[model samples]
Target: MLTSVYRLVRPRQFELVFNDITLDKSHVIVHPVRLSICNADQRYYQGLRAENILRKKLPMALIHEAVGRVAFDPTGQFEEGTLVVMIPNTPTEKDDIIAENYLRSSQFRASGFDGFMQEYVSMEPDRLVALPEDVNLSVAAFTEIVSVSYHTIQRFLRFSHSRRDVIGVWGDGNLGYITSLLLKAILPETKVCVFGVNEYKLHDFSFADDVYLISDIPEDFHMDHAFECVGGAASSKAINQIIDYINPEGTISIMGVSEDFAPINTRMILEKGLRLFGSSRSGREDFLGLIKLYNQNPDLINQLEKIVGAEIHVRSIQDITRAFEIDIHKIMGKTIMIWEN
Candidate 1:
């Protein structure tokens, strides 16, 4: 039997994936689920439109971040009621459409598959994560973004020795704050400095050792390593700035996606002998480590709550456009969709 799955679609554009499939035999057939829409982005939609028209291809699916309950799992690793985060990455679940024929194939369940914006969703048993007893399922929605930071840090830390080293972060958005949180937790002795646009965006970042409003590097401050959490032209500028001021041999880990092309100062990079790296999804080991770290230091999680901007109900999925506006206004730190009982 086929189940109905709702998707956010644009006219001749990409649809969000929310897979609904039948099990051979299962105790529960339908599970009501919730999906967090990462603020509706008109620019993103426009970009998709332009790409489609340019390439003469139809539009694609939208959602890349989400968390949901188990719908069906015959093997019993995931029960119908367990709360979990979906790892949209391919390697963790090889059966994913993207992984089957390499990422070039867009057949994955969430990224390319049907997403979780509907009343019911069908996901593989292994895709479900049993949330810890103490973790609130609602807030757990940020897990995917946190995992992005986790994976980015894992790559940067591979080169560093002690947490006492100082790290620089460019951009003060959700990813930047979370990246700092992960770094501070792992390297308690490390001092972090975050640079961003407005004072309001950087307020929660009072925890940072230093906060810079100006984009240029200060004379006194020198970074052992740097992270570019803002994508686009700003990220490219930050990359060049880091290359100019970063301590010789330091590494740069880029976490955010970019829209416009930015020139990289290859001359400075080669002169400084810097180590630049890029990471996509967090490995299973990275997620497990983050979970362990979160469990040990719940305070970090508490701090993260400060940046959490809004908790609107899932029933308001249609209001995602308004949600996006709220986020852009900086009225909400991290916007989450509440899945009600």
Candidate 2:
């Protein structure tokens, strides 16, 4: 069957390309119903990536965060019309020591292959996770990123010291809000504080134990651990600032994406005996665990509802372009496209 794929032929340009998708019993067909715009997708749409990288990766469908209905399930595991979230990381091999997301052989959607910006996505049943039928569609669209926070926090739990009294999340963006919210649900007894430069954005973290502007933090304030959600050129400053305020031996989980190398203070890291690690795309298990968490805590999804920003109905390339433009101009929050193709 021929499938309609929207590809970015160049910056600020999208072309409708058709590709043949073999109708096989091994693959399940998903009709993407709701797609979320990501910063990575924005980078490609705006030509923010390196020229070489863009030259190689452009003319490819973008968007990894999406939810859809099972249009066809030959395996009989999921029924037709069932709601599901697609996992982007496709692993070629399994390893006991390294998770699938961490494996070098994994092919991530949008990054390594055609993403969900198509009429239909063909993926193995194992790459899809069922979601509650009544779940919020706009909130569900960005499950991929939420699962990243879930995956990172799970690792932080295993790697960090037992001092779970206070945890700091730097950045008041959607990620920081989600990370701090997840930390509260996962570690209710622990305090989660968010730090950011924007007071307006920081106010959105109403659930946080406390929100402080980075420059206004108390002199004696400290946290047992920190998660850096501030990426881009500010990556170095966020990491180094965390180092100064975090307690000795605390684990710093890096979830930010930076194009240029951001030099951090390694001297203080060594002196403080800090442990730093980076987390990116998540695996199937992370999505499963996160959905379970959402089910257990209904209020969690309610909180997620607050971050659902502009929801545009996209039925054509022009609509998709308008959606991306809206996403770029928004101060914060997720921009979702109700995929009508």
Candidate 3:
């Protein structure tokens, strides 16, 4: 048995639990796993599904996106030492629950299965991807978050008519910056504009060419595509702002998770012929593409340094809950976690 760490959540509380992982005697033993905590949180903690599988009246570990290294794997595909990232999404292993369709039934590692906050973790060899030497552990920690942008952008491009479309991303948070970068990376000719609350965050990334602080938005700007990464009432207002600027027949991809309802202009949505949708954890292919980008561009670590606001080691599980309660802006570009064994 190996000792590991896991985060847990309830309707209104957060906790951490130490876990024991054991391999069946028949399974081969693999060694030395590298693990790190993540900065992102789960969408919801209470639901019917949460009660069934985890058997937890409360939820388990909130963070879903992170990067780690595989110390060992029996298959030899992942050897003793490999810098890798885990794609949290996993297909349902349950045979009894037939998903109406594969898309409807897919599961995720941190969501419904085991997650990565631990002293050691044993993962499937095929699930791991070795990182490039240039990728630092801290910046690489955001590989999953970065992929969220990549996946969202690809979805828009795949469904849109033009590759050179103009895109306006709402919010200048880390996700917003990465979304712009991913679009620029894939569609270099695409015009990228950003809506952010803080002018500083907007300037942090070179790719957000046209940035605005809601108060000074350009009314005439037209968008073929837009992304919603703001997660509060403020963000909802930003979404409304996006609606004002989008062109007729435009598409808005919402990837941010919010706790409040921001009214949408239903009439204008119809009048503008808008197609708005949301995205959560990404697909396997998107994660793979993120890895490829991390490998190809050595400077991502440096560029990403601005987004990882701070780092906090886990002294106790209680700290995890407190971590989230603190102002997120104070910790912008920072990562908080309990690091002790």
Candidate 4:
């Protein structure tokens, strides 16, 4: 079957391309219903990445976060019309010791191969996870990113010292909000404190135990561990600040993406015996685990709805472009394109 694919030919330019999709017994056809804009997607759409990187990756369909309804299922694993969230991380081989997301051979969607910005996407059964039937889908569209936070927190449970009485999350963005909220729910005993520059954004973290402007954190305040969700130029600042306030033997999970390398205080890291690890994209297990977590706590979904931003219905390339433009100017929250393609 030939289906319409919207690919970014250049910066701020999208063109429709048609490609053949094999309808095989191993694949399930999915109709994308909603897509959430991510910072990584924005980096590509705005041409913020290096020219060489863009040249090698462009003329590519761009979106890794999307929810869809099953149009057809040959193997009967999923019934027709089942709502699901598509997992972007595609692992060619699995390892017992290494998780699928960390494997070097994994091929992620939108980054290189065609993503879900198509009229119909042919997905393997294992690549899709069913969503809650009555849940808010606009919030569900960004499940990929939320699972990322879950993945890191799960790792923290294994890696960090068990004295997680207080945890500090630096970054007032969506990732920080989700990470902190999950911590509050998953580790009910832990006090999740969020630190950020924007007062307005900090106010939105009502679920957090404490929200403080980075500069105003009381001198006596300290946390057992910290997470740096602030990516880009400020990542170093956030990481270093966490190190300064975090107790010894604490873990620092870094989830931010940066084009250029950010310097870290290696001396302080060694001095404090801190464990700093970087977390990138999530895998199938992470998505499955997160959905299970959501099922147990439906209220989490209700809280997630607060972060849903503009929902623009997109049918034409122009509407998609307008959505991206609107996403660029969004002060906070996730921008979703109600896919009508």
Candidate 5:
């Protein structure tokens, strides 16, 4: 069968390319139901990435955060019309010592390979996780992002000290909000404090124990653990502040993406005996874990509802462009695309 794929031929340009899809017993074909725009997607769409990187990565389809329905599954693992969340990180090879997401051979959608921006995606049975029938499809669209937070916090729990009293999350963006919410759900006893510059954006973090502007934080305040969700040029400052305010031997999880190298205060890190680690894309296990969390805590989905800023219906290539255009300017929440095409 021939499939229509929307590719980013260049910055601010999209071309619908046709390709033949071979249905095998091992593969499942999924039709995208809803899609969510990501900051990384925006960078590529706006040509904000480095010139060298763009030259190599352009003409690739964008969007990794999405939910789809099984149009055809020859393996019979998932029935046709089953709602599912698509896991974008496809691991070509696995290692015992390293996780699938960390493997160098993993092909992540919207990065080096084509993403879910096609009419139908032909993937392995393992690449899709079934979504609950009652689960909201719009919220499920961004399950990849929620899974990332779930994955990061899961790692943080294993690496951090047992003291679950106070945790600080820096950045008031959607990432910070989702991470804070997950921390609350995972560790209800722990106090999650969010720090950011935008008061307007920070106001949405009502689920957090406390929200404060980075400039207004009390000097005496400190946390046993910290998560730096602030990426980009400002990440350096966020990490520095985390180092200064985090208690000794604290574990810091960095989830931000920055094009240029962001400097950290290694001297302070050493003195404080801080353990810093980075988390990027997630894998199948993370998605399953997130689904379990959703099943356990029905309220979690209600909290996630606050992050839906704009919902754009995408039926044509022009609608996709308009969604990205609107997404670039939104300061808060996630811009979701209801895949009508």
Candidate 6:
């Protein structure tokens, strides 16, 4: 079968390429229905990555967050027209102690391998999760993003020694909002405080126990554990604040993606005996857990609806470009691309 793939041929340039797909019985063919533009995609689209890295990674398909329908399934595992969320992390090898997401042999779509920006993507059956018939395709499109928060918090639960009370989240972006919301959903008894620079963005975090501007954080405010969702240039500042406000021996989970190395207060980390870790991408288990969460808490879908900033019906290549252009400027919420072409 020939698949039409949209690739980033060069910085800010995309080209359509055709590739033949030899479908295996172990794989299911998916036709992307809706896609969400991630910040990482924008970094590549805008050429924000280092020149050398860009040169090495160009001509690759550009999206990892997407929901699609099974068009062809040789094994009959999923019915045709079934809505599904596509998992991008492909792990070829596994270890007893290491999770698949952290496996050295894992191949993540849109990072090094071809992504789902194609008319049809042939994927291993395990790489796809069936969505509920009534599931919101727009919200399901970014399940990958929500699953990251699930993965991070699940890891934090294993590593933290604190009471899980008074949790703090740094950043006002979609990540912080989702992380805080997940914390609330998973541990409703715990108090979640959010700190960020943008008050307008913070307003959306009404579910949080409290939302405070980073500049006006109470002097005596402290957290038992913290999550740093702020990335890029402002990451250093957010990390410093998390270290400063977090209690001794607290756990800190870093989820942001930064282009350059960001320094943290090592002295404080050591002095306070804080445990810090980073989480990226996610695995099938996380995706399943997120679905279970949604099943348990049906209101989660309503809460997630608040994060949909813009919806673009992509009918042409120009629409794809326009979605990226609009996404780069969004301060809050996600810009979703409904695959119409």
Q: Report backbone clashes per prediction.
A: 11, 0, 17, 0, 0, 0
| Candidate 4 TM-score to native | 0.99
Q: Candidate 2's residue-wise lDDT over 254-336, tens digit each?
A: 99999999899999999999999999889999999999999899999899999999999999999999999999999989999
TM-score of each: 0.82, 0.99, 0.81, 0.99, 0.98, 0.99
lDDT of 3 by residue, 1-341 (tens): 75645556554355556667776422223222223333334333333233444454334555555555555465656555566676666654544543211355775655555566555655555455667655666666667778777777777776655635688888777677778777777776878888887887788768656788878876677877788888755767877888888888888888876656778888999998888877776666777787777667656556777676556655555655455444243625555343454
lDDT of 4 by residue, 1-341 (tens): 99999999999999999999999999999999999999989999999999998999999999999999999999898888999999999999989998888899999999988888999999889999988678688988999999999999999899998898999999999999999999998999888999999999998999998999998989999899999999999998898899899998899999888788889888889999999888888998899999999989989999999999999999999999999999999989999999998
Error of 4 at 132 (Å): 2.7
Q: What is the C-alpha RMSD of each candidate to the true structure, in Å?
A: 4.2, 0.8, 4.5, 0.8, 0.9, 0.8
Encode model 1's per-residue lDDT on 70-132: one tens digit a residue: 666677676566766665554433543332224453344334444444455555544455676
3 versus 4: better TM-score goes to:
4
Model 6: per-residue Cα lDDT at residue 237: 91
lDDT against the true structure, each candidate: 0.63, 0.94, 0.63, 0.93, 0.93, 0.93
Put down candidate 6 lDDT per residue, 249-291, tens digits, no spaces: 9999999889888988999999999999999989999999999
Off by over 4 Å in 1: 11-20, 25-34, 39-49, 53-61, 92-110, 160-164, 215-217, 320-332, 339-341
> For candidate 4, which ten residues in a row score worst on lDDT?
131-140
Model 6 TM-score?
0.99
> Candidate 3: deviation at residue 218, Å?
2.2
Deviation from native of the Cα of residue 68 in model 6, angstroms: 0.4
Model 6 lowest lDDT segment of ten: 8-17
* Cα-based lDDT at residue 256, candidate 4: 82
The lDDT, on a scale of 0 to 1, for candidate 2 is 0.94
Q: Candidate 6: global Cα-lDDT? A: 0.93
How much is 141 displaced in model 1, in angstroms? 0.5
Native-to-model Cα distance after best TM-score fit, residue 251 in candidate 4, in Å = 0.8
- Greater TM-score among 3 and 5 belongs to 5
Q: What are the runs in model 5 whose C-alpha is more than 4 Å off?
A: none
Answer with 1 or 3, whichever has the higher lDDT. 3
Ten-residue stretch with the least lDDT total in model 2:
17-26
